[model samples]
Target chain A: MDDLHSPDPTEQSWGSLLRTNREEVLEKWTQTAAANLGGRMTPAEMGRDVDEIYSALVRADTGDQIDIRSAAYADLRSLLTELSRTRARQGFSPTETAVGVYALKDAVLEILEAHGDLPGYRAFARLSRIVDDLGMFMLETYATTREAVIAEQAEALLELSTPVVKLWDGIVALPLVGTLDSARTQVVMEALLQTLVDTGSEHAIIDITGVPAVDTQVAQHLLKTVQAARLLGAECIISGIRPQIAQTVVALGIEFGDIHTKASLADAILLAMRRSGLDVVKSR
Target chain B: MDRIPILRIGDVLLVSIQIDLQDQTALALQDDLSSKIVETGAKGVLIDISALEIVDSFIGRMISTTAAVSRVLDAETVVVGMQPAVAITLVELGLTLDGVRTALDVDRGLALLSSALGKAGSDVEVDDLAHE
Candidate 1:
């Protein structure tokens, strides 16, 4: 909306006149922010943040600067980004942050109305559009940053959940305890294969005793894990074949091929020990 | 013409494939191994493929053929020292190399051969005892 070479006289004068009532607009903006902020922040901190953006806008000679994407609003864009990220980290909602920007329209309009020598209708339209654009930028940045934070947290949680343990000499156990998905399956396979190499174990017992249910995808993931173990010359024995799971497996007609499956972890471990040439004799 | 050398170690012919195998080299190794097993009358063949990072279908088929040919000649073939990445890739390639037996390393492969030999020795002892 602004022309750098041919400055609109009315637009230039509006910006010049705006500086005269800067203190009054700053006061009203902080009051509206304090009222809307609702105890989340002290009035002093809220006032300080609003003061910085207000001076930048007035100095940018934001008369007729309606288009936020234009070079004229570059400083405003960066300022809003910093504000949105800080508020996102502070656990403030997007609407709350956007409303802080939106509340500016009322404060500025009131200040201009009291000055009787207001700009023409065209200049007023440009000022209103600028505030609207700033509000939209704040909401957009808040949403995008919040989603990124959630995704990072999920990845960290996945790493924590998958754990590989060496159960005995020449034997390792991967006790799975949640719903299996492709992403988690990749982690499980890599962990199991690495431990198999580290321990040089001949047999690995994958106990899914804590697994909630099974489906075609889960079965496929399990098969991939078993196949990978076998490639390393380590035999895989699936444990926790509960009757319900057995029924589901049979109903699905899923053939496990030559991969071993046992009814319980104890049975699987015993089989693994036997294959590793351990004879567990009962003490009489 | 990178011919993978086949060495006769006692009753087992040890072949370590330590090259980026071309199709001809793999086929030549298969032919050389089969003839060596027959000429030495070796009871077992140990193939150390730890250096074979990629096992494409042609190389895979050559190994399977060698195993089949040796089995017909009363010899057992065990491929050993396969890397974990190669194994995972081979499985993904849908070539499990099912017809052949495998071991983690040369030591385990030797142990596997000796244990079977030991079992054969006991069978002979039992036969002599039965005759007596």
Candidate 2:
């Protein structure tokens, strides 16, 4: 009974069985995934992703063992990873991205059910195992892709937050607006110091009004920044010290050591101007 | 055995250290600077370290000591043009060089020195008036 159309299920590998029904399986898989995604992706894009994965799966010679991590499935695994990365970048949920691979199981099962025999049922089970491994792989890829996206955004946020603004001639100001961790403080310190040299500004104001809390560690960071600026021969004035922050600084026994602290940015600018020998007088 | 040259501009003694200072060289420079400050009767001392890229803790201490010696001689000391990396390294080493003033460059250093001299002159005048 070695017929091309009706080969014995036990004698045929799942790869060959899959190849024989590739068109039907791909169409069914794409349709199910499209419904699951609520049509967020166009049909052409969905079809292309499904087509790539199906071709790679049919080419993989799983034989008896169904390890997706095996060398036999390397091509298939990479194809699935690529699909998941695209889905993740498009903002698809984990379940939605993984379901694209899982849908192949139902499509294969439908084809096996049409045969209606015990051997056909056994073949479906083996294929089902391979599909399960692939779905998990897709899920793992999705997680890593999302994590990469988050890390890139966090770095961008750090850059956007710390801006060394030139307030006036011989005066620059850094408006701090977040938690002062060691990493952020290091970035802030370097940027301020570089600006001090580039602009030849003798006075700098660090406005901490947006800083929500002041622990000993944060106070230490501020002191380090001011000291670094002083090394460049630029004086730094810490401004926007709300009453609460002042109390916290005193309570924590953090000695700013003669570094000027002002109540507001405006006051800090006024002091910086006075030190630079400039006075603002209103003209009538 | 090379000695760092000490240049005098107006009332400011300019010590531009261009070489990586050895311990003996630093000691010799310190001696020469102090004697020159006395001989010239300079009002301010400007140390341009922009050419120096590397400094150990010994050199850091030498700078502070030089400033102290200048201060005792009735001259203000200003360290100018310290590189950012050098500044960070010094801070990390915990050498803050307390009591030594800093400027961005020799131009700024001269300005700082003159302004300081101006203030000191006015303070002397006030003291004279108080004595009267």
Model 2 stretches astray by more than 4 angstroms: A1-11, A20-24, A42-48, A62-75, A109-129, A278-284, B20-24, B35-43, B72-74, B118-132
What are the candidates' C-alpha RMSDs? 5.7, 5.2
Top DockQ hit: 2
List DockQ, one per candidate, in order.
Answer: 0.25, 0.40
Q: Which of the numbered candidates is closest to the native, going by highest TM-score? A: 1
Candidate 1 docks at the CAPRI level of acceptable
Interface RMSD of each: 8.1, 7.0
Q: What tens-digit string does per-residue lDDT give for candidate 2 at A136-162?
A: 889999999999999999899889889
Native-referenced Cα lDDT, model 1: 0.77
Query: Against the true structure, candidate 2 has what lDDT?
Result: 0.84
Scored against the native two-chain complex, candidate 1 gets a DockQ of 0.25
Q: Write the per-residue lDDT of candidate 1 for residues A136-200, one digit (tens) a residue.
A: 88999999889989999979877987788888898999989889998998888888887787777
